[model samples]
Target chain A: MSRIKAVDILAGGFVVLIGVLAIVESTSFDMGTSRRIGPGYFPFYVGVLMVLLGLVIAVENLWTRTASDFGWSLPPMRSPFLILAAVAAFAVMIERFGMFPSIFVAVFLGSLADTNTSIWQKLTISVAVPAVCVAIFKYGLSLNVDVIRWRP
Target chain B: MSDFASNLALGFSVAFSWQAMWYCFVGVTLGTFIGVLPGIGALAAIALLLPLTFGMEPAHALIMLAGIYYGSNYGGSTASILLNLPGTPSSAVTCIEGYPMSQQGRAGVALFMTAIASFIGSICGMLIMAIFSPPIAALAFSFSAPEFFSLMVLGMVAASTLASGSPIKGLAMIGLGLILGMVGRDLYSGLLRFSYGVDQLYEGLPLVAVALGIFGLPEVIKNAGQITGRTVEARSISFASMWPTRDDWRRSWGAMFRGTGLGSFFGALPGTGGLLASFMSYATERRVAKDPSRFGKGAIEGIAGPEAANNAAVQTAFIPTLTLGIPGDIVMAIMLGALTIHGIQPGVSVINNHPDLFWGLLVSFLFGNLMLLILNIPLIGLWVRILAIPYWVLYPFIIAFICIGVYSVSNSVVDLYVLMFFGVLGILMNILRFEPAPLVLGLILGPMLEENLRRSLTLYRGSYTVFLTRPISALFIGIAVLILAWTIYGMFRARARRRAALAAGGE
Candidate 1:
């Protein structure tokens, strides 16, 4: 099966499963005053609607001419690898550099795939955006953080 | 004359403080940056800065936050039009016509036109706010719980109109979102609904984490492996100057007017707010266009109308929020936090109490729009250059930034675990062709909805009919029912057509 169809089936199945579970689980509770719909009442209906909708989606995809948009193509993986690395680095160094430096550094080095960027421009951006962000957010606003300690 | 003069002078006095001006500049700049980058939204930007804004004076902090909110709305079209990637949910309307324009190599014209259109929209919305805020606030104050619930239902039904792929899929996604929203603690009894005994799901999902995971990470994953080399056979179109031609002005002015009209109405509609404004604008533009076929094929009207509507909606939505103390949307919800932190009660009393805040905010909006126009028009070329950055280098940083931003929100490692878990769920959501925006909207509004629904029941002596008996509530519910009926009919017809086609094929 195509990925789109595959996912549709799985999602449909999951929705159905959730609906069944909600129905089964909700039955144990006292549905309580008819004047006020119990907590389970809204959820039970929502679950039923989900299952019905999922079935419709699944059956429709099976019978209908749905477009296959999710094509599988593995382009160069360098960017993905780098992106993961940058995320890891940021997650680790956030406390050290603070939100400003951490974000600027991640966005800067993370944008390194462009052949158009000069060393000077990169250096300027790398230095400038973080500093500006720090000045504006931390010092100017008096936001408390220990990343770049300033004594005036 | 004396009152007008005093208010104007006082507004300028409050808005012109050096610190306020600097924050405005910072807010506009940050707004532009986020707008240029796909998947980073104004709401996320505002939420991240909420903590930082805690220290500044209420007016200055809110001015900056509000600037970022609308500034990003203005700039979001740059990437969508030029790069075929929407920078925010609101800008997806641009992508229908914008990506095609880029493919035709009129990316520059599209970018320029959108920027101009945004400025016009911002100016118009501000004018509206300046002239009519008190009346609008007075109207908004009349809404009660039943009316609010009806409004929320209207928003939920309208989720299908969010410029999405399939109507059934869209509605189904909304259902899914509502279910996901119900996964946390039950508001009335304090009992868990769908927690499955996991402590992480106790307080429900955070809006930022869910937004980042569902919308942000999926796009990154999709784009991570795709090559972005532009191969435009069509010659690129450039304006002789920054100024739009008289014809451009004529075409766009109508769109701006129409957008403002739609924006004002949709922005006031409690739950969806600016989201519906952008969608409604695009749909209206499509319906009204002389050549309807040109939409989704590089129509400048497509860009102009929706961009205008989105920004206008952002500004006008504040009227209801600021005056009523009820949030019009999630961004306003975060701004509510800012208000409470600054010790300001956002209600009828705000105008009675702090005239500086009310007038200053109004005037700062005018100043902020001017600053945004000056800031974005010249920076179009610089923004386009951002697309030149390679995926390998950019993707990791985006992922890392998402991680850090989510983690920093509460200084809780538990939130990180919650984020990662939802990140997986988000990827699955994408795979299932579900639009995540409504889901995020649901999660944000769920708590409020529960609280109000219960309060209304209590008020009515446990009578459910109270919702329908109230005039405003009845009207809103009536509209919601009509919308739902229309959607159901539409879905049935589409499904029947598919079945007919299948039978005709002798299957």
Candidate 2:
């Protein structure tokens, strides 16, 4: 059995990986002297610091016992995915379909995350949200995007 | 005194204009509306409105935005008191005592006192801003690249440690934010760091989109169907019942004043802001109370203290933002972004370059607070009704609004993708129990930090010792080192205590 707190180790390892990536990428830039510091200097040092900190965090459980549970439980993925999907749908369809359909699709997908709302309720929200958005963003604010774009 | 009078006169002349006053009214009304609604914050509201200000004069746009910022501080307390929902992060402390007071049928009184406390705090904070800002700006004029770099370093340190969560995690988030901020082309080398072939990212990520995604979207996701409709009891909120008892009055005044003082101190400090101030005020009030047991069960001091502190902090947060070109909080960062969008560079020279903008904004706070007091008191019923709107209805609108808000910023689909990216990131951070506030401070200050670091190094002819040798820079670095050392000590002590407890449990 792993005595290490899985959450801490995973989070810390992720940080270390990001820092390593930053260091690796930064080496491509000029490593000028301190007097005339290059673009890589600040990021390189920052990455090194991040790696050190991440290492300490990863190993912290060895020195001290944490009250937090040792086991790792995945966060409920349903709502997070649905919410991101809603936003992604809007982003993908917004330029092509314009404001109305994009927002309707976004709201419909977003409303599904609730799980308590009926299909009828979701449909109502989809229609109502787009209408309000059109009034506010299109008419009231006069945003530059087309209401129903068919072309780029 | 005469100079002060003349400055006030000029400020009044600019802020009292019909256009400025009208927009101020509109901003505060909208601010109060959103502030009463749960799961949405001033950051999202301000970002949503940023695009609409495109056609207005910079000063008027700023005055209105500032009104919304402080006004939300006032309005946020309403949700905390009435429904146990914090409208904004700063108001989270208000729910501790305010909700209990409401449950005991003192809801009206709590609302009334919060408004009064908010008024007092805003007035004091505005006065401090007026009195100290000129000298502060003058002092900032002498600061060079070394001093700025040290100051930013101190700021990042203070922000990461003082924010809610583990200090190490906060620091990690700051590092992550700095990396994200480096996505655009380096100013000196003109080499793109992390754009990954996306042309829209050449200027870096949009601040509005990132903020909304991180702060706003996660909130909606968490509370999607969780918030049901809440009904406010009629007898609990009559206008006649809103008056505080004699004991309530006696207990609250000192707490309000103490809260104001604490708030002004913390708000003026770079990186710390209203959220920390409010929590500190609540803690202080509980510590000093005659019977601490009254605290969680309807203590008037709890509501009075935090409400006052948050409002004061909101006003004084501008001190660093306008004077030093550094934001004191996330909202101030967005406001600074707004100034940049309007073609005004925020720094010490802002006072000298645009006296009207600085002075007028300060003066407008007086009117904004007065308007909020009226809006909160006589019109309390309207906001109470607003609380009854179901989360299902409210959140869908929020999602739609967020999508439109992000899309409108630069009219770019890529920014929308960035918004979605940060939204997922925000949810992940939440699961990991990381605070998002310091990350924002890091993101906004990252470029400035890099710029100052390079400038300082170049100026000193590659001498690393210049940082320690310079008096002001040395002072800032020393303070940062002291804070870091103290935090580490505290962490070790806590760990030791926890280990001792575990040993005792094992036995």
Candidate 3:
């Protein structure tokens, strides 16, 4: 027996979830006559079509037999986890803490993902990156953000 | 011909202006900068730099962005030759011959020939774009709502089908994109569709944020620690060694022209771009070579042909994008988003309404290619040195820029969250083998597609038959149907063959 491809199953299920959400949400909007397409008309049809497409993807994965098919495997979570945390840190801190602090922390977090670098190297990078960025984005380009502020 | 001359005169007038020329220079320089860096691509660079153009003139903005797009093609081959790494996807073909050529100590010759080929190809492609675009736009003027809807359908179907993944998944991504496009408030009724209680999304997902989130962040995440300091060792590429022999010139000139011809054709076609064009040119060169055995083992024609083809394709890819408002790939899709940010509706009217922007951009290609030729030859060492920059140091700056870039798009912190959300989504989609290019194309085209669909329905009094009844529209639909059927048929046939092989193995 062939092992099921988890990638296709997950992709199909994820798509189905999105389709159902679209269909469910679109039902709230007006479904007018075809002559005058309501907001939902385009989306509602798109949703139904998506649902069918999702099902096809899921079913096709089970029927097809091929070792050449791109097998699903978990990506190296270290980089993704650290990098995402960095972006999240930036998002959460950018408003409340301000630009410099937000960027410093984010860069610090992002820099930690590199095992090749030492703590001293990471800290220097975290500091230098934000300084150069402030010069470029903040000073050079005049990006409208405070270098430091206490919003909270 | 008079119209062509006068239009070109107008183009020169706009492009020669010092400020416009300055933006163009900066653009190509930066484009080459990131293009030489192994892991970072033109797409991510464009996204990262896109926000900086917000304060500029629309014409200059487009000129800069366009410069980045083509300049990267020139820079991409450097890494391919020196290292086995490709700076851009289209330049991957270069590595096959380029790395071998470098190994054989003919790296300088390969580099020089590629620059010369790229320059010729770009010039020819630009000329073709200049000559062909007006007529194409003129043809597009006759296209109405049904025709537009059909064309968009054709474009979406064609783009997804041709994209690197399962056609169904591509279609599904497009569907997701369409839903994302419907997030903003409805134009007619003013009803919000999928804002999902987040009031910030009423203006639609910020294009810059969405683009940067999808293309920019994932690339950084994937490459941050993974590809560490790649240094160019003691071998320095001096200008003295770059000159080619008489035989080299004779072999390469024909290959360059042939590659340009193939690239211009493939590039102008919807959904396809430089990657496909360059590969085609490589195959053509191999087929037409006197001794095909020379191909994989440091063939001058290999580098010359593909480099020419990719650069030529880069120039012609703008033809469909600027004329049809339907971008062919992820890069073009970002470019289309750039125009939308500047309040320019890309279509047939773009040429008629914004002649200066269109013509000036076309003219800038000449200057940009010239800039690339200079950068590639005399300044080749600078780029080689650039390869030595450590990834750990580079990626933090990249992450910082991404965050600030997304934030500065509208000064909304909410956009930051949006960026984070899509960054994760991008990673997830990457795992599922979903090609983000189709999704992006679908997202950008979604609103226009919906608008055209509604208008066609209204104009034909709710008659869906109008799509088929109209000749041009019907033709487009027919093409879309044919492509979809062909793709599905191909998939089934492959599956059947796989089954047969499995049965044989069992026996």
B318-419 in candidate 2: lDDT tens per residue? 998999888888789889889988999877778879999998998999998999999999988888888878888999999998888888877888888899
Candidate number achieving the greatest DockQ relative to the actual structure: 3
Best candidate, lDDT-wise? 2
TM-score of 2: 0.97
Report the alpha-carbon TM-score of model 1 versus the true structure: 0.77
TM-score of each: 0.77, 0.97, 0.97
Rank by DockQ, descending? 3, 2, 1
* Error of model 3, residue B486, in angstroms: 2.1
Q: What digit string (tens of lDDT, one per residue) describes model 1 on residues A70-124?
A: 5633344454445444455555556666666665665565455433556665566
**Could you list the iRMS of every candidate?**
5.1, 1.4, 1.3
TM-scores, chain B, all models: 0.82, 0.97, 0.97
Q: Return the TM-score for chain B, candidate 3.
A: 0.97
Model 1: per-residue Cα lDDT over B1-507, one tens digit each: 577678778889998888888888888878887777765677767755665565688888888898888888877887777667777778888898888877776676677778777877777777776666666556656877777676666666665543355555666666666666777777666677777777667777665566665656556655653644543233333344446657767777788778877877676555456667888888998898888987777777888888888887787777656765556666776676568658996655565477788788878887888888776676666666665565544554455546655665566545555555565676666656666656665665555565567667767877889889999888878887887687667667766887888799999
